[model samples]
Target: MVVIDINKKYPEIWEFLAEVPDPEIPIINLVELGVVRNVEKEGDKVIVTITPTYTGCPAKKLFEDLIREKLIEKGFEDVQIDTTLSPAWNTDWLSEATKAKMMADGISPPTDDNKVVTCPNCKSTNTKIISKFGSTPCQSFHSCNDCLEPFNYFKCHR
Candidate 1:
Protein backbone atom coordinates (compact mmCIF):
# COMPACT_ATOMS: atom_id res chain seq x y z
CA MET A 1 0.00 0.00 0.00
CA VAL A 2 1.38 3.37 -0.97
CA VAL A 3 1.68 5.83 1.92
CA ILE A 4 -0.37 8.83 0.86
CA ASP A 5 -3.39 10.81 2.04
CA ILE A 6 -5.23 8.73 4.66
CA ASN A 7 -8.53 10.55 4.09
CA LYS A 8 -8.65 9.18 0.58
CA LYS A 9 -8.23 5.65 1.90
CA TYR A 10 -10.98 5.84 4.53
CA PRO A 11 -13.36 3.66 2.56
CA GLU A 12 -10.70 1.02 1.97
CA ILE A 13 -9.75 0.94 5.62
CA TRP A 14 -13.35 0.55 6.69
CA GLU A 15 -13.89 -2.19 4.15
CA PHE A 16 -10.90 -4.10 5.49
CA LEU A 17 -12.00 -3.69 9.11
CA ALA A 18 -15.45 -4.96 8.23
CA GLU A 19 -13.93 -8.42 7.77
CA VAL A 20 -12.91 -8.66 11.43
CA PRO A 21 -15.66 -10.41 13.38
CA ASP A 22 -16.56 -9.92 17.01
CA PRO A 23 -14.74 -12.42 19.22
CA GLU A 24 -17.89 -13.34 21.14
CA ILE A 25 -20.56 -12.89 18.52
CA PRO A 26 -19.09 -14.47 15.42
CA ILE A 27 -22.32 -14.16 13.48
CA ILE A 28 -21.93 -10.40 13.25
CA ASN A 29 -18.88 -8.42 12.23
CA LEU A 30 -17.40 -5.74 14.49
CA VAL A 31 -18.88 -3.02 12.33
CA GLU A 32 -22.36 -4.55 12.57
CA LEU A 33 -22.01 -4.62 16.36
CA GLY A 34 -21.38 -0.86 16.33
CA VAL A 35 -18.07 -1.38 18.05
CA VAL A 36 -16.09 0.59 15.47
CA ARG A 37 -17.04 4.24 15.92
CA ASN A 38 -14.61 6.20 13.80
CA VAL A 39 -11.38 5.99 11.79
CA GLU A 40 -9.05 8.91 11.30
CA LYS A 41 -5.50 9.68 10.32
CA GLU A 42 -3.16 12.22 11.85
CA GLY A 43 0.34 12.61 10.41
CA ASP A 44 1.34 9.01 9.75
CA LYS A 45 -0.73 7.42 12.50
CA VAL A 46 -4.18 5.93 11.92
CA ILE A 47 -6.47 6.25 14.91
CA VAL A 48 -9.49 4.00 15.41
CA THR A 49 -12.15 4.84 17.94
CA ILE A 50 -14.40 2.11 19.34
CA THR A 51 -17.18 2.03 21.91
CA PRO A 52 -17.76 -0.96 24.10
CA THR A 53 -21.20 -2.49 24.34
CA TYR A 54 -21.12 -1.95 28.09
CA THR A 55 -18.88 -0.30 30.59
CA GLY A 56 -16.13 -2.63 31.86
CA CYS A 57 -16.73 -5.10 29.10
CA PRO A 58 -13.81 -7.55 29.07
CA ALA A 59 -13.85 -7.76 25.32
CA LYS A 60 -13.06 -4.08 24.94
CA LYS A 61 -9.35 -4.64 25.25
CA LEU A 62 -9.49 -7.56 22.89
CA PHE A 63 -11.30 -5.39 20.37
CA GLU A 64 -8.61 -2.75 20.57
CA ASP A 65 -5.89 -5.32 20.15
CA LEU A 66 -7.59 -6.95 17.23
CA ILE A 67 -8.16 -3.61 15.51
CA ARG A 68 -4.56 -2.62 15.98
CA GLU A 69 -3.32 -5.95 14.69
CA LYS A 70 -5.57 -5.87 11.67
CA LEU A 71 -4.45 -2.38 10.71
CA ILE A 72 -0.85 -3.36 11.19
CA GLU A 73 -1.32 -6.40 9.00
CA LYS A 74 -2.77 -4.08 6.39
CA GLY A 75 0.52 -2.14 6.36
CA PHE A 76 -0.63 0.70 8.61
CA GLU A 77 2.24 0.48 11.08
CA ASP A 78 1.37 3.51 13.20
CA VAL A 79 -2.12 2.37 14.15
CA GLN A 80 -3.67 3.71 17.34
CA ILE A 81 -6.82 2.36 18.96
CA ASP A 82 -8.93 4.71 21.06
CA THR A 83 -11.77 3.65 23.33
CA THR A 84 -14.46 6.32 23.51
CA LEU A 85 -17.32 6.52 25.97
CA SER A 86 -18.37 10.12 25.35
CA PRO A 87 -21.51 9.43 23.35
CA ALA A 88 -21.69 6.04 25.06
CA TRP A 89 -22.73 2.83 23.36
CA ASN A 90 -26.36 1.81 23.15
CA THR A 91 -28.05 -1.08 21.43
CA ASP A 92 -29.97 1.62 19.60
CA TRP A 93 -26.79 2.33 17.67
CA LEU A 94 -27.23 -1.00 15.90
CA SER A 95 -28.64 -0.71 12.43
CA GLU A 96 -31.75 -2.46 11.15
CA ALA A 97 -29.66 -4.71 8.93
CA THR A 98 -27.62 -5.85 11.94
CA LYS A 99 -30.76 -6.57 13.95
CA ALA A 100 -32.14 -8.62 11.14
CA LYS A 101 -28.91 -10.56 10.88
CA MET A 102 -28.97 -11.32 14.60
CA MET A 103 -32.58 -12.41 14.42
CA ALA A 104 -31.82 -14.64 11.49
CA ASP A 105 -28.96 -16.17 13.44
CA GLY A 106 -31.36 -17.00 16.32
CA ILE A 107 -30.13 -14.27 18.61
CA SER A 108 -32.74 -11.67 19.52
CA PRO A 109 -31.34 -8.21 18.91
CA PRO A 110 -31.78 -5.37 21.38
CA THR A 111 -34.66 -2.95 20.99
CA ASP A 112 -34.82 0.74 21.76
CA ASP A 113 -38.43 0.73 22.94
CA ASN A 114 -39.77 -1.25 25.89
CA LYS A 115 -41.84 -3.51 23.72
CA VAL A 116 -42.24 -7.24 24.08
CA VAL A 117 -39.24 -9.17 22.88
CA THR A 118 -40.26 -11.51 20.12
CA CYS A 119 -38.89 -15.02 20.26
CA PRO A 120 -36.45 -15.69 17.46
CA ASN A 121 -37.52 -19.31 17.19
CA CYS A 122 -41.26 -18.83 16.86
CA LYS A 123 -41.69 -15.10 16.58
CA SER A 124 -43.89 -15.18 19.68
CA THR A 125 -44.18 -12.26 22.02
CA ASN A 126 -44.94 -14.60 24.89
CA THR A 127 -41.52 -14.71 26.38
CA LYS A 128 -40.26 -14.60 29.94
CA ILE A 129 -36.85 -13.67 31.19
CA ILE A 130 -34.99 -16.67 32.51
CA SER A 131 -32.10 -14.57 33.63
CA LYS A 132 -30.93 -11.00 33.34
CA PHE A 133 -27.62 -12.21 31.99
CA GLY A 134 -27.08 -14.80 29.33
CA SER A 135 -23.89 -16.45 28.09
CA THR A 136 -22.51 -12.92 27.94
CA PRO A 137 -23.13 -9.78 29.94
CA CYS A 138 -24.66 -8.01 26.98
CA GLN A 139 -27.36 -10.67 26.60
CA SER A 140 -30.20 -12.07 28.70
CA PHE A 141 -31.73 -15.52 28.74
CA HIS A 142 -35.36 -15.72 27.71
CA SER A 143 -37.75 -18.55 27.01
CA CYS A 144 -40.82 -18.33 24.89
CA ASN A 145 -44.07 -19.43 26.56
CA ASP A 146 -45.54 -20.22 23.15
CA CYS A 147 -42.74 -22.26 21.65
CA LEU A 148 -41.05 -23.20 24.90
CA GLU A 149 -37.73 -22.49 23.20
CA PRO A 150 -34.90 -20.91 25.12
CA PHE A 151 -32.90 -18.21 23.44
CA ASN A 152 -30.56 -15.35 24.17
CA TYR A 153 -31.90 -11.83 23.97
CA PHE A 154 -29.46 -9.01 23.36
CA LYS A 155 -30.06 -6.67 26.27
CA CYS A 156 -30.72 -3.04 25.60
CA HIS A 157 -27.99 -0.67 26.71
CA ARG A 158 -28.58 2.96 27.44
Candidate 2:
Protein backbone atom coordinates (compact mmCIF):
# COMPACT_ATOMS: atom_id res chain seq x y z
CA MET A 1 0.00 0.00 0.00
CA VAL A 2 1.26 3.45 -0.92
CA VAL A 3 1.11 6.24 1.62
CA ILE A 4 -0.29 9.58 0.52
CA ASP A 5 0.95 12.90 1.79
CA ILE A 6 -2.09 15.18 2.19
CA ASN A 7 -0.25 18.47 2.45
CA LYS A 8 1.33 17.93 -0.93
CA LYS A 9 -1.71 16.31 -2.54
CA TYR A 10 -4.44 18.70 -1.33
CA PRO A 11 -3.22 21.67 -3.35
CA GLU A 12 -3.14 19.54 -6.46
CA ILE A 13 -6.69 18.45 -5.69
CA TRP A 14 -7.81 22.05 -5.32
CA GLU A 15 -6.27 23.08 -8.61
CA PHE A 16 -7.76 20.14 -10.45
CA LEU A 17 -11.13 20.60 -8.81
CA ALA A 18 -11.31 24.17 -10.03
CA GLU A 19 -11.95 22.87 -13.52
CA VAL A 20 -15.40 21.62 -12.51
CA PRO A 21 -17.93 24.29 -13.48
CA ASP A 22 -21.50 24.60 -12.32
CA PRO A 23 -23.91 22.84 -14.67
CA GLU A 24 -26.58 25.57 -14.42
CA ILE A 25 -24.15 28.45 -14.83
CA PRO A 26 -21.02 27.25 -16.52
CA ILE A 27 -19.34 30.61 -16.05
CA ILE A 28 -18.87 30.02 -12.32
CA ASN A 29 -17.06 27.04 -10.85
CA LEU A 30 -18.51 24.99 -8.03
CA VAL A 31 -16.03 26.53 -5.60
CA GLU A 32 -17.43 29.97 -6.29
CA LEU A 33 -20.91 28.54 -5.86
CA GLY A 34 -20.00 27.80 -2.22
CA VAL A 35 -20.48 24.12 -2.82
CA VAL A 36 -17.03 23.00 -1.90
CA ARG A 37 -16.55 23.52 1.82
CA ASN A 38 -13.39 21.65 2.70
CA VAL A 39 -10.90 19.02 1.50
CA GLU A 40 -9.34 16.50 3.80
CA LYS A 41 -7.27 13.37 3.44
CA GLU A 42 -7.11 10.21 5.53
CA GLY A 43 -4.63 7.50 4.68
CA ASP A 44 -4.72 7.02 0.92
CA LYS A 45 -8.26 8.28 0.48
CA VAL A 46 -9.22 11.91 -0.02
CA ILE A 47 -12.37 13.33 1.55
CA VAL A 48 -14.12 16.36 0.12
CA THR A 49 -16.72 18.16 2.19
CA ILE A 50 -19.43 19.83 0.14
CA THR A 51 -22.65 21.75 0.77
CA PRO A 52 -25.43 21.71 -1.81
CA THR A 53 -26.64 25.11 -2.98
CA TYR A 54 -30.21 23.96 -2.28
CA THR A 55 -31.80 21.02 -0.53
CA GLY A 56 -32.81 19.43 -3.80
CA CYS A 57 -30.21 20.91 -6.10
CA PRO A 58 -29.82 18.50 -9.00
CA ALA A 59 -26.30 19.69 -9.70
CA LYS A 60 -25.07 18.02 -6.52
CA LYS A 61 -24.74 14.66 -8.24
CA LEU A 62 -22.81 16.17 -11.13
CA PHE A 63 -20.56 17.96 -8.70
CA GLU A 64 -19.78 14.72 -6.90
CA ASP A 65 -18.92 12.98 -10.15
CA LEU A 66 -16.79 15.88 -11.28
CA ILE A 67 -14.80 15.82 -8.04
CA ARG A 68 -14.26 12.09 -8.25
CA GLU A 69 -13.28 12.24 -11.89
CA LYS A 70 -10.84 15.08 -11.38
CA LEU A 71 -9.17 13.34 -8.46
CA ILE A 72 -8.91 10.14 -10.40
CA GLU A 73 -7.45 12.02 -13.29
CA LYS A 74 -4.86 13.37 -10.91
CA GLY A 75 -3.98 9.73 -10.01
CA PHE A 76 -5.75 9.60 -6.65
CA GLU A 77 -7.19 6.08 -6.61
CA ASP A 78 -9.43 6.65 -3.58
CA VAL A 79 -11.64 9.72 -3.29
CA GLN A 80 -14.73 10.32 -1.20
CA ILE A 81 -16.99 13.35 -1.24
CA ASP A 82 -18.94 14.08 1.94
CA THR A 83 -22.03 16.24 1.81
CA THR A 84 -22.81 18.39 4.83
CA LEU A 85 -25.94 20.43 5.36
CA SER A 86 -25.09 21.89 8.71
CA PRO A 87 -24.76 25.68 8.84
CA ALA A 88 -26.77 25.43 5.61
CA TRP A 89 -26.22 27.33 2.40
CA ASN A 90 -26.89 31.05 2.29
CA THR A 91 -26.28 33.92 -0.12
CA ASP A 92 -23.80 35.21 2.43
CA TRP A 93 -21.46 32.48 1.18
CA LEU A 94 -21.24 34.25 -2.16
CA SER A 95 -18.12 36.30 -2.56
CA GLU A 96 -18.28 39.97 -3.46
CA ALA A 97 -16.04 39.30 -6.46
CA THR A 98 -18.41 36.60 -7.70
CA LYS A 99 -21.34 39.00 -7.35
CA ALA A 100 -19.52 41.60 -9.40
CA LYS A 101 -18.81 39.01 -12.06
CA MET A 102 -22.49 38.08 -12.14
CA MET A 103 -23.47 41.70 -12.64
CA ALA A 104 -20.95 42.07 -15.43
CA ASP A 105 -22.35 38.94 -17.04
CA GLY A 106 -25.80 40.56 -17.28
CA ILE A 107 -27.16 38.77 -14.23
CA SER A 108 -28.03 40.94 -11.25
CA PRO A 109 -26.43 39.70 -8.09
CA PRO A 110 -28.27 39.04 -4.87
CA THR A 111 -28.23 41.78 -2.25
CA ASP A 112 -28.23 41.22 1.45
CA ASP A 113 -30.77 43.97 2.09
CA ASN A 114 -33.33 42.77 -0.49
CA LYS A 115 -32.98 46.05 -2.39
CA VAL A 116 -34.44 46.55 -5.86
CA VAL A 117 -32.21 45.09 -8.55
CA THR A 118 -30.47 47.36 -10.98
CA CYS A 119 -30.24 46.82 -14.71
CA PRO A 120 -27.09 45.00 -15.67
CA ASN A 121 -27.10 46.29 -19.24
CA CYS A 122 -27.69 49.96 -18.54
CA LYS A 123 -26.73 50.11 -14.86
CA SER A 124 -30.08 51.75 -14.24
CA THR A 125 -31.82 51.64 -10.90
CA ASN A 126 -35.16 52.13 -12.67
CA THR A 127 -36.15 48.54 -13.27
CA LYS A 128 -39.55 46.90 -13.01
CA ILE A 129 -40.07 43.39 -11.86
CA ILE A 130 -41.68 41.41 -14.61
CA SER A 131 -42.02 38.08 -12.94
CA LYS A 132 -41.23 36.55 -9.57
CA PHE A 133 -39.56 33.68 -11.37
CA GLY A 134 -36.72 34.09 -13.79
CA SER A 135 -34.91 31.52 -15.88
CA THR A 136 -34.17 29.70 -12.66
CA PRO A 137 -35.86 29.36 -9.30
CA CYS A 138 -33.10 31.40 -7.67
CA GLN A 139 -33.71 34.43 -9.85
CA SER A 140 -36.45 36.88 -10.80
CA PHE A 141 -37.20 38.46 -14.15
CA HIS A 142 -36.93 42.23 -14.51
CA SER A 143 -37.02 44.71 -17.32
CA CYS A 144 -34.98 47.87 -17.44
CA ASN A 145 -36.62 51.01 -18.81
CA ASP A 146 -33.30 52.67 -19.56
CA CYS A 147 -31.92 49.98 -21.91
CA LEU A 148 -35.10 48.05 -22.55
CA GLU A 149 -33.23 44.90 -21.67
CA PRO A 150 -34.76 42.16 -19.62
CA PHE A 151 -32.49 40.67 -17.01
CA ASN A 152 -32.52 38.05 -14.31
CA TYR A 153 -32.10 39.10 -10.70
CA PHE A 154 -30.54 36.72 -8.26
CA LYS A 155 -33.02 36.27 -5.47
CA CYS A 156 -31.88 37.00 -1.95
CA HIS A 157 -31.52 33.53 -0.45
CA ARG A 158 -32.70 33.36 3.13
- State which candidate has the highest lDDT: 1
Candidate 2: Cα lDDT at 84: 92
Clashing pairs in 2: none
Per-model TM values vs. the true structure? 0.89, 0.86
Question: Candidate 1 on 9-117: residue-level lDDT in tens?
Answer: 5888898788888899888888778778789899889988887888878898889888888888989999988888767677776778999999998998887553678
What lDDT does model 2 reach? 0.81
Instruction: Report every candidate's CA lDDT.
Output: 0.83, 0.81
Q: Residue 90 deviation, candidate 1, in Å?
A: 0.6
User: How many clashes (backbone N, Cα, C below 3 Å) per candidate?
Assistant: 0, 0
lDDT of 2 by residue, 3-30 (tens): 2222434677777777888777777777
